[model samples]
Target: MHFQEESIDCVDFVLRKDEVLTVILGGGKGTRLLPLTEKRSKPAVSFGGKYRLIDIPISNSLNSGFEKIFVLTQFNSYSLNRHVHRTYASNAVHQKSFIEIIAAEQTVSSVRWFEGTADAVRKVLPYIREQRPKYVLILSGDQLYNMDLADFMQNHLIDPETEISLACNAVPEDQVYGLGIVKTGIGDSIKEFIEKPQDLEQVESCRQTSGQFLANMGIYIFNTKTLIEVLEDQSLTDFGKEILPKAIQEKKVKAYVYDGYWEDIGTIRAFYEANLMLTDDIPKFNLYLEKTPFYTRARSLPPTKINNAIVNKALISEGTILNHCEIHRSVVGVRQFIDHGTKIYDSIIMGLNRYGSLDRQSGKIPHGIGKNCEIRNAIVDKDCAIGEGVKLLNLKNVTEFEDEFVRIREGIIVVPRHTTIPDGYEI
Candidate 1:
């Protein structure tokens, strides 16, 4: 199925923006993405140099004209809450558009934290009911994609029989191992649904004649009544594992096939590869679109300064200073300071939150990458102070190792936030 640019008349046929409530599920303990999630929530983690992971879904919802949005966060949500408040607080005063953050809280009835995705939404049903929405759009916070959700809403409204609509992408069979696979019988109607099926025969049953399997994108649009009815069962916690499979059996669940670029940054390796993919000549996920632009906090930082730096295929964010350094296939975030004679390749340098003191004291390591250092295939988190002549090259190619200063996962070294490495140290 092809998704063309929606005409004005087509958009007018869909439900009003106020009648559609959008919910972005801020993820739980992001165990796969270890040190990155150590301090901040998964959605608040930095991505593409400047933007947070939560920005993707919120921007897509706003650009698509669905303004009444709520973000449900659980673990380590302080940074995520702050970012949402500072960036989107202005929208609440508008007539019909607002973005609100709903962190997990305990009430008289329930004291336990959110157990899973469905549970999170179930607990926030009171706020959702206040909007009087006819449909609810569910989104994942840590995904990378630009979708026209207005178009998606229009499609869902076209078929009144569709009580639940799932956005699906066609992926190879090999990629369906950890993903929810759906089998469509006729005319986009899902016949069977399985979450991470381990048996090969079960997976093969979902493969299409085009040699691809339909994998769930974790994007769901549900009729307000259907959502409430499914959540009535307290036993069902997760949507993929518990709720969806049962819904397919009882309700009219349909699949909206999407051929666009989408990546779930669930693991550290996936996050690393996704960040480096932006440095490609023509990345699948385009960040330069004008109509559907990615949104983030508006900062008043100055332009990046490059002093004789031989940079190639890199995304250098604002207010960074590079002095005679050699960088290739890397993403340097805001307010970074890289001294001379440093070489960075295939790495992500998450810049500092604020500029550190420049006064060079004896044995005092300053923030950012120091001089004469070598870093390759690693992720340097925010506010890290790497001493001069330190090396993070993972020379031994260790698959997994962890220490106080750094961690090596999948052969990529990660310097956690605010770590200060001594001078002349080597990994």
Candidate 2:
């Protein structure tokens, strides 16, 4: 089917916020993003230095005037719950809007945890039914993208017969192996769906005339009745692997082509690359967007303090204190303290959670990077204490190695959160 570009007049189509409920899937184990997900849930993992992974989708929903959101989390959800509560709790009082965290719980009928994406929503059907929303918007928590969900919802409403509208992007053939590919017959009508096509012929068949495959962005808008109907079959576990393919055959599923910067931060390499990409002069994902601002917890802290630091192409978040350090092409997160003579390049330093009192009296290593350290092409997770003269360069270029204090994945060193590397340590 030939697709044409047309202007969408959003002024005529007003979306009632109360009629749509946003459900963010945050229960995935995030095994691919391990070590980072060892302590926190996938959504709670830090992203772009300042914001958590969940903040991207939640902020997008809020900016699009969809305020009633439910974040479903299961594996290691304490931090995720706390963040959502603290950051979005005030919305309930001031704006009459709320972003609630729905952790998995054992019920009379189900004693197990969330098995997959569809299963997670299926278990929450009772709570979803109570909301009485005309449409339900499902989003992934671990992706980095800014979308006007109101626009997406408007497109879904354009076709009354579109029971489920999937937001898709045209990706190259090489990128189709990890994403769900769709085949369209007519304008925006999805005829066939395949999850992670591995066979060469299967992947080639799904490619469009433009020589690009329609890759699912894991963003879906479903009629409330249709969602409930699809989840009625308990056999279906995952959305991409099971639910979407069956729904395309039996239900009216459409495609909403999105031409924007979207990156699925599923692996450590992807996460590292995505963070570093933000340091570019013209990044694909713009965190500095004015209208659709990225929202997170409001920490009333002092501004970032740089004292004679030579920094270039770096994203230094709020409340960071840099002293005579040379940083280039890196992302320094919130409340970071880099001592004098330290040099960081092509790295991501996830800063400390708080300031002050780091075992000074006990002679223990304090939080933040110590003096004279050289870190390159690495990821320093939150609240790590690297003693003076420590080098995390991974000079040998080992692909995979792990120890008590550090881990090297895909040739990038990862110093896990709350870890302490003693003085004169080298890799």
Candidate 3:
């Protein structure tokens, strides 16, 4: 089914913004990302050289007029909480439009943390129930895509019989076991949902006549009452693993098929590849759309300055100073300092916050990339200290590596936050 630009009138005819509550789940430890999530939560991890992963979903909600949003966070959430509070301001004019964080907390009855995505929402339902929202939209935090949620919600509002609406996409059949697979029956209804189905028949059930398999996008809009009933069952932890499959059998589930540029940054390699795509001549997912712009924490920084640098296909963010460097197909974040004779290719350097002192005598912190370094197919995280002449080529062609300062996954080197690579070091 085609998803045209939905009308505001149609959205208003169905439900008001206040009647629907948007919940963003961003508490994952992001183990696959490793050092990137070493100090921050998954959602707080920087993306596209400027914004955080959480910004994608939040921006989609606000741009689509779903303003009453709540982000559920845990596992090193200090950075995420700070970013949310600083960047997203509450709408005093409307009063109902607010972006708030609900971190996993300890209660008298239970001191345990949130077990899974569904469990995270289940524990927070009591507070959400007070809002009296008709529907609850649940979203994954670390996904990169642009979605007009109005279109997704309108499908459910127009079809009152659908108690649960999910955003699904057609994926390759080989990936059926890696994602939540949906089987659509009559009228686009989800007849069955197989979460990471291992059985051969169950995988075959997800295949469509068009030679594609239906993969769940982990985006769900649920009837408030039905959600409450489902969450009341304490055994159901993950939405994809437990709740969704059972919901298809008991409740009316509908699929809003989305055919767009959506990337789940599940691994370091995926994150690196997605970011590098922005440097291409024609990016699959353009971030410069004025109609639905992405939101992020704005920094009071100056424009990037390049002095005689041979740069090509790069996204250079503000407050970076590169001098006589050769960069190709890379993303340079804010406040980065790259000296002369350095070559960067297919890499992501998460810029620093402040300029570091080269001299140790003044007791100033040391950071940023030093001179004459060679970095390729790597992810240089924020505040990393890359010494001069250091080479990060993944020389051994290793898929995974574990070290004190650097880690490699799928041949992508990840320099953790605040790591100081000694001069002349090689990886």
Candidate 4:
């Protein structure tokens, strides 16, 4: 999606004159990205090799100049919290930044975790109310995309009548149910909103006869006043399931068409596909946009090296050394070492989790060169020593696994770190 002329103006300036607080929703268990999310929340899960999933939104906020940030986390928040403090603690951006973790709590009236997205925000309403932020920017922590939320907020400000502004992208007919299907008027004012529809008839009806269905991008800019009212109303618990539809029905919500690479990494396949997309010759999501560049905690390491390795369309992070190995269509995390004669294809290796169940891909073998080793279409976690002579090529049944030695999720095998499957073993 190309940026429309109107959006260009939205992105060119910081629209909100008042102080804005960015509320990052980081509460999902990410069960769909299992094995990987087995040890960490979706936000703490490493991505693009070196960066964690939370970095995507934090970076977006820093680059967009939205320094005041609050991340709401419920399940598995330890690692997520540590990552934030370590990465966003001492940068020039940090001087003006306030990124913290807000977990689920229990009060006298209620004793449970965040019930829903709206509830998550509502529970923290007092905290935000104390800060008196003029606008509250609510964002998801697991989606893979770079949006200039400043642009989104600007549009909402310009459209004075709007109480809620949602950033959305048009999706295919079959994929509409995974997100909120919205119906809007000509000038992009939202008329109606429906949470995930169950059937084709509902999908077609929400498509607005324009043949393009607007799927929520999980990015929202709310007028703090309206947001507080909606959140306190107890009846409104989820943004997609209640808040949004209610707002649209009241005729005050607007839709901002987001024309950029936005992918909901809600499943293993979607996460894998999004990572592979980054390895393209000229990726659809341009990471090199200077004006509004994607910012992450920089590693002051040397460059990567592929000696005698036949590398093809892959992203290898800094301090990585691949020797006589073939890597194709994969994302290798930082400071990783792929020994000679090893071949990795169509996988994602998050090198940070290099021990215990923390890692995903298990090592090929310890030592025994009787058979040949071939790992194709799999995610090999860090510190896995794939010994010589073990074949992992499951061509006929790509999703089949012989033993628990290698775990499979949505057709991707996860080899946990430091796992030693002795060589000559055939699967």
Candidate number with greatest TM-score: 1
The segments of candidate 4 whose C-alpha lies over 4 angstroms from its true place after superposition are 1-17, 90-96, 107-110, 208-210, 300-302, 352-372, 398-402
Candidate 2 residue 168 Cα shift, in angstroms, is 0.4
The numbered model that scores best in lDDT is: 1
Which of the predicted structures, 3 or 4, would earn the higher lDDT when compared with the native?
A: 3
lDDT scores in order: 0.90, 0.88, 0.87, 0.74
User: TM-score for each prediction?
Assistant: 0.96, 0.95, 0.95, 0.87
CA RMSD (A), model 2: 4.3
Error of 3 at 243 (Å): 1.0
For candidate 4, write residues 162-272 as lDDT tens digits: 888889998888788678888778678887777898876876766756677889887998888989777768866788888887777664888899878888888877877
Instruction: Tell me which residue pairs clash in candidate 1.
Output: none
lDDT tens per residue, model 1, 269-371: 9999999999999999999887788888989999999999999999999999999999999999999999999999999999989987865675578898889
Model 1 stretches astray by more than 4 angstroms: 1-14
Q: What TM-score, to 2 decimals, does candidate 3 have?
A: 0.95
Q: Give candidate 3's root-mean-square deviation (CA, Å).
A: 3.2
In candidate 4, the residue pairs with backbone N, CA or C atoms under 3 Å apart (3 or more residues apart, or in different chains) clash, namely: 360-415, 360-416, 361-381, 361-415, 361-416, 362-415, 362-416, 371-389, 372-390, 373-390
In model 3, the worst 10-residue window by lDDT is 1-10
RMSD of each: 2.9, 4.3, 3.2, 5.0
